[model samples]
Target: MASSESSLFSMAGDSYSKYEIRRRNPNPTAAALLVIDMQRHFASIAAPILPALRSTVALCRAAGIPVLFTRHRHRSPADYAMLGEWWSGDLILDGTPAAELLPDIGRDPGDRVVEKSTYSAFAGTGLEEALRGMGVEEVIVTGVMTNLCCETSAREAFVRGFRVFFSTDATATSNKDLHEATLKNMAYGFAYLVDCKRLEAALAPKI
Candidate 1:
């Protein structure tokens, strides 16, 4: 990677920060870490944040915060929805290697993995129910495509009553503009923006 994951935070300068109104840390006990679409199809865009994403998963696990992952793939044309038309069917098919989650995300046997065909994990995947069942009131969103799946999931989580913590560095997109746009959108209305260092401090053990 040309730029380290920590450097991704430098993009969240005055423009993005100006939209931030509420600055609050996450409640670990009531929070779950959401790893969204960290699959092979998005390897290029996801590579820069893999280190930070792995660290985030480890930190949440250490803090006893349950971790959930979302995998996006179209089983068939029937499940493609608007995605098939939008990208002219340049979609991830279910049986392909691209549909598989990156093995390095530190996903464990007991961690919940939700499969969906759309941008928002909660759209038809029952992710909201799963989170509620786990007694999770807060979600820390991290993974590939900051302006797509990650951002959509974070916004959906917010509307569905979960306090969202959107990671600035642990999430990435095709370009800096889309990534920064999502950060600003999150800070403005949907979620509180967070970075790896902030998460470290928030999830640090109390004396």
Candidate 2:
């Protein structure tokens, strides 16, 4: 694609995400923020969205909302599962710095980090149980690969009976088409689509 066309695609997604239409407003009393796969590799491509994500994290923290992050790591070929053949190269190797969350997100030591080897944070993970244990009813999903990890996790959350709030500006992807597709898919059926400023503002008044 030409540089101009790519830029146009980027602008189009930004325009579409400007509106914060949602199926439901997150109940601050029963909400959690799932920051999925915000590691070095994807985070570098999606760096522009981190400011919005960082601000959202701050608001959630102030509100005493549970903020959990998922680190995508494969310890061995056995653990790779479908992700092994789906992607062309090794990703988020265990014990490597690349597998760790980016340093700029202001993650505290007390914060929880769930390690996963798949796209959905809930897959083969204790995320569901942990949320249930916390008495969380709503999950505000944010992080990298909007069409992949974010979308899958949102749908999984919905099926598990958690009200899903998908973050438009706070989630990022390398391609605009895939990102927009996820947003539309979530808005059409699975989750309430939200943006950074609006979500932050809503949480602010209560925090």
Candidate 3:
């Protein structure tokens, strides 16, 4: 293939690229913020992005947008067969510190907390129902493991007919390349990509 043809095919495969999805402000009533797998294990490696994550959460709260947090939990060894042998030891056991959300972040008593064992929050959890119950049509996603849990949840949300806004800075992976790759992929086709700062400004109360 000619160089231009190759370039065209490459760009065609990417849906999250800026040239593909022009960034737009989310419609107010349709949007809610979804914080996925922001527990201790992931949060520890994401310490650098803590400030940005916190700010995003606060902005959503102030805007009266529903904020949902997902906690990954799995069964113990005795009951783990149902969850799969591959997850036996790697699971985030219920009530364990590793499964707990970071306390320093904003989490109100009334905020919805959904426990999920799988990568996609909507797979086994009531996250979709909860969002629907609240009349939410758009999801602003942020959290850990940009290429894993976060990306999975965002894609699921999109397939379920919700507009997904994925925060670039509020998510982190074990390596920068994986993180960037996930963002690029999601932003190109799966979700709307926004940095924490832009999202915060968008959610800020009009003066």
Indicate which candidate wins on TM-score.
Answer: 1
lDDT of 1 by residue, 93-192 (tens): 8988888888888899888899998899999899899888889999999987788888899999999999999988788876776777887789889999
Global local distance difference test of model 1: 0.83
Worst 10 residues of 1 by lDDT: 1-10
For each predicted model, how many residue pairs clash, with residues at least 3 apart or on different chains? Answer: 0, 0, 6
Candidate 2 — number of clashing residue pairs?
0
Candidate 3: residue pairs that collide: 15-188, 15-189, 16-187, 16-188, 16-189, 17-188
Candidate 2 lDDT score relative to the true structure: 0.78
User: Residue by residue across 1-207, what tens digits does model 2's lDDT show?
Assistant: 011112211212365543335546678889999998888766455577777788878888887888999988888888877777776375678887777688888588988999888888998899999999999999999887788788899999999999999888788776777778887788878988777666766776733
Q: How does candidate 3 fare on TM-score?
A: 0.83
Sorted by lDDT, highest first, which candidate order results?
A: 1, 2, 3
- Best by lDDT, which number? 1
Cand. 2 TM to true fold: 0.89
lDDT of 3 by residue, 33-78 (tens): 8887777766545576677778888878778787888887765555
TM-score of each: 0.91, 0.89, 0.83
